[model samples]
Target: MRILIAQINPVVGNLKENKRKILEGIHAARENGCSLAVFPELALTGYPPEDILLLPQFIDEVKKELKEIAGATQGIAAIVGLPRANAKPFGKPLLNSAAVLFEGKILGFQDKTLLPSYDVFDEMRYFDRAEERRVFLLFGKKIAITICEDIWQHAALSKDVSYPLDPVAEYANQNIDLLINLSASPFSQMKAERRIHVVQKAAKTLKVPALLCNQVGGQDSLIFDGYSVVCDAGGRLVRLGNGFQEDYMVWDSEVKADELVAAFDKTEETYKALILGLKDYFGKQGFKKAVIGLSGGIDSALVACIAVEALGKENVLGVSMPSRYSSEGSVKDAVDLAEALGIELRHVPIEEPFQSFLDILSPEFKGKEPDVTEENIQARVRGVILMALSNKLGHIVLSTGNKSELAMGYSTLYGDLCGGLSVINDLTKRQVYQISRWINRERDIIPVSSLEKAPSAELRPNQKDSDSLPDYEIIDTVLEAYVHDHQSPDLIAKNHGYPKELVCDLIRRIHRSEYKRRQSPPGLRVTDRAFSIGRRFPIVQGWV
Candidate 1:
């Protein structure tokens, strides 16, 4: 039997288009003489439909589309992920389900056994766990079908997941011929290896071939990398699908396949993930042009490069808003970067507006020394110029605040934080440099000066980032432990050999910046624990 894995990108809430994609995949699979075709979890309504799943009309529409999709499955069998209404009138009113369609009819659904409620996933809010596990016979082979988190019960591979039932393992003695998992797993650093390991373990446990069909494309802050997989019975990878985009592959049981080994470069993978995320964010929302405020700094430079790559240089516009504090080299770097990028460069000097603000606030600050308030005016003046361009030019402003600055409350809210989207808010200062250097590996794309220059906001004279915050090395280390790993300040300081007071102070800053983050634009999430939708913190909390 030949099984076609259809890794598709589905826009959430677009039932008609998603249905069309599924039908197209089924037709293609049938043309290839494949017996079975598989799609990713929640392929119909898209993964993590979120509050849309709460709408009865949306579920009803999905059912209508599923019926049509079932009727189209004449020459081939298909397993599609969708939301199934809970007829029992209990347990969340819906099931995260996979509908099995064969020969123009609807077969029984295999509901997702594990409803993940951590990090970016909140499926338990809208879905109920599967009551039982079952094996189905398709093309004379007994197969166990699982949904995203259902097959993630492997002990060593599970990331903080604790489930009572192992859905795939339940069919251990049932003589299953294949184990299939339909996934909408989001992309994070090193997630592909973990996924490969999971499928390998499942194939070995079942002693049968295993396949995974993952969803692709970006949905809000989440980017589903479609690196689908197929593993042979001995737990070796046979087929690997495309990464960071939609793909399709067929695995034939009769044809012997060899293991395909691959290595993932962290920097390259992250760059691709960000590119996809940016592309989809703009494309899905009907955004055609992007306007970035280039400060001759690393953050804005990186965002501009990514925007140019994702949306084309024609669609990307760079504006250099120079102030009194901005250095001549900084302004020159912006011009050189934009010229090299082949994008339209507009010089919008904020010096006039900045001086105006300082003059106006002179009376209010009569006796007060020039402090962060005066510095913030410069940032806010730049922000106003960017917003005005965005308003007049029909382009989205891309904010260029990195994660380290965002974490330590180093950014000025309503100033540098003003944008429709934050491109690198998830990447730390260290990662920003890493990716910037990687971009310049072959040639100088992201200006070597931008990479080597001291990090600064240029809000005032000689305002290096290190003057206010710790070194990028120390900050990134603490952020990885405190923010992502959820380690305590004392433990982080002890483990990383940092001063306890410094660590504690950094943690406090992160907590105090909750209000700023809350107001910041939604950024592309490349990390497991981004400051986006998943990591919830209270702005008024005193927990720190």
Candidate 2:
């Protein structure tokens, strides 16, 4: 028997487009004479419809689409994921479900047993837990179908953490011939290895061929890298599909066993993931062009470079929004950087807007001198101009704030935070510099002056970031410890050789600014935890 895995990228809520893709995948698999084909989790409505799942009309539309797909499934057996309605009182009436279709009929269905609740997921808020597991016979083999999180329970990371029962294990005991898992698993650095290890271990223990079909493409903050694979009973990889792309791979029982041991290209995998993420976010958000505020800083330079790489330079507009606070060398550097990157450079002086805001606000102050408030006004004024241009030209503005500034509340809300997408919001200040250097090393697109210039927001007269915040090296260390490591203030201070009070103060600012991040735009996920949806903190809360 031939089994095909169709790892595909589907647009969320675009029923017509997603259906077209699924039909194409099914046709491709059928042409190869495959008996069964598997698609990723929520393949019908895309990975996450988010709150769109709440609309009754949307659910009805999904059911209609599912029926349409079922009618098209003649002669070929397929398993596809979608949301199913469970009309019970006093709870969310939906289940993350998979349906088996064959010969123009719905054979059976299974609900996702595990609903991930942490880190960019609130599945518990939307879906009820499935109560049972079952296996279906097809092509003389019993197949156990599971959703993304369902199979993950067997390899759950924490032993102390109580979780739902392992559905795959129960099915394994039921003498299944194949274990099929559908997923919309998002990308994180080195996460692919963990996934492969889990699947391999499961295949070895269960003594059955395991197939994983993952979704590809970016959906808001999540980027699903589709590195789907098939592993034999001995835990040997049999077939590997492309990562960061829509691909269909067929595994036959007759092919030589040694041919399946080929490895995936790691560097190309990560590069494609980043590119696909940037492309889909820009494309799906209905932005024909992207306007980035290029300050000749490493962060902005890196973001501009990535923007150009993702959306051609013709679609990318670079603006050097300079102020009196901006150094002359930095102004030259911004112009030079734009020329080197082949992006259009426009100089917009914020001196007029800065003076206008200061004049309006000065009368209300009773002899109080200028401070960060005045600095923030400059940032906000520049923000207003970018937004205005964005509105005038129908371009989406991209903010360049990195994770370090975001973590310490160093960024001004409604100022630098005004953008349709925050490209590097997940990267720390240090990683921003590192990626900048890497981009320059790989391709000499970024100007050297951008790397050499002192980091500054240029929001005030003779302002430097070091004046208010610690140097990036020190600040990023403190940030990583407190944010990603989730270390206590005392532990962070002891580990990083900083005063406990200082660490405590940094954590306090991060908590206080939860309201700001909550309103910020979706950003790319280059880290394990990013600011947007992944990291959740109560906006109205106090430190104990």
Candidate 3:
């Protein structure tokens, strides 16, 4: 049987457009002489419709579109994900399901069995679990299909205990010829690797060829890397689709699986994901231009390069709001970097605004020394200037603060943190440098001075990041343990050989800055744990 994996990007609630894309893919499948075409989970309504699933009218519309799509599946069979109504009134009114279409008629649907509730997923709240498994015959072969989470029971998230009922496992010993899985799994660092392992294991367990098709595009903060994969029963890969973009591929059980899977590279994958995330966010949101506050630091420089790569140099505007404390080299570096990227650089001096704010607050700060308040005034001044530019020009601001700074409370709220999106907030300070160096490896995209110079906020005289916190080399190691690994301060310090006091203080700052992070713009999630929907921390909490 020839199967075409239609990896598509679907907009949420745009039923008409989604149907059009689905029909287009089906037509292409027929032209390619493929017997079947499969799309990602919730291909009709888009993945994780979130609260839209709660609306009864919305589900009805999706069903309406599904039937229409079913009618168009004439020459080639197509499987698509959509919201289906459950006749039983006891549970949730909807079931996350996929329908098989053949000869312009409905071949019925297979509801998702596993409803993931942990981390970013809340499927249990909206979708009812499947009662039993079913098989559909196509191309003279019996096929057992599973939804996204249905086949992820053995993933690392499951720890060691398997689900009470494995949907794919249930089909074992049934003599199934092929196993198909529909997925809309989001991008997390190394998540693609974990998915490949799951697909390989499932194929081996069932002793049949397996294929998985995932959605691609940026949905809010989540980015689905469409690396649709196919593997034979021997745990060998047959085909792997493109990453970070919508793509199409075919897999035939009769053909020999000789195509080599692409090698895994974390840095390369993350760079592409961030670009796609930013590009799709603007494209889907109807944004045409972007603005970035170029502080001339490595963080801002890296973010500028990424923005240029995503939106093009013409669409990106670099605003350099240098205050009195800003170094001459920093200002020059911002101009040079913008010139190198061939983007417009706006020089809006914030010195006057900084002085005005200090002059107004001098009376209120009668006895207080000129401390963080003065420094923050500079940052807020720069923020106001950049935002004003964005407001007038209709440009989305890309916040340049890295994950390390945000975690350490080293950034200003409504200041450097003010933007429509945070492109590098999920990346640590070290990661920012790593990608910067990687970009510069081809040529000098980022200024050499920015990399060699000590990292600074440039809000005060002789201000440096290391003056307040530990070195990024040390900070990232501790953060990886404390944040991603969920290890305690003591354990991180002991295991990673970090300074106990520094690690404890950093952890304390991370907890205290919860309110700040909660208000920050949506950031692209490159790591397993990002400061978005996936990582939920109470703003008011005690961690003594």
Which candidate gets the maximum lDDT versus the true structure? 1
Candidate 1 local accuracy as lDDT?
0.90
Local accuracy of candidate 3 as per-residue lDDT tens digits, 1-544: 9988999999888888889989989988888889999999999988879998888899888878888888988778999988888888799888998898998899888999988887778888888999978999988999998999888884535542356877877898799999999999999878888888889989999989888999999888889999998989887987999998788797778888785666878888899999999998899888979999888889889888888889999999998888888899999899999999999998888878778888898899999888888888888887888888889999988898889988888889989999999998999988888888989998897999999999888777898888888888888888788888898888888887867898888788888988899989999888878876678888876654
- lDDT (C-alpha, whole model) for all candidates: 0.90, 0.82, 0.87
Q: In model 3, which regions exceed 4 Å deviation? A: 155-157, 160-162
Give the count of colliding residue pairs in each prediction: 0, 0, 0
TM-score (C-alpha) between model 1 and the true structure: 0.99
Alpha-carbon RMSD to native, per candidate: 1.0, 2.3, 1.3
Models 1 onward score TM values of 0.99, 0.94, 0.98
- True-structure lDDT of candidate 2: 0.82
lDDT by residue (tens digit), candidate 2, 353-470: 8888878888897599878898888788878888999999998999988888887788888989999988888888777766677677766677777787778887777778888887
List ranges where model 1 is wrong by over 4 Å: none
Taking the tens digit of each residue's C-alpha lDDT, what string does model 1 give over 1-544? 9988999999999999999999999988988889999999999998778998888899889989999999998878999999989888777899998899999999899998898888888888888888878788888998889988887886356566788778877888999888899999999999998999999998998889999999999988888889998999999999999998777788898789988996899999999999999999999889989999998999999999999989999999999988888899899999999998999999989878888888887888898888899888888888888899999999999999999989999989999999998989999989999999999999998888999999988888978988888898999999999989899888998898999999999999999989999999999899889998789888887689
Candidates ranked by TM-score, best first? 1, 3, 2
lDDT, candidate 2, at 390? 95
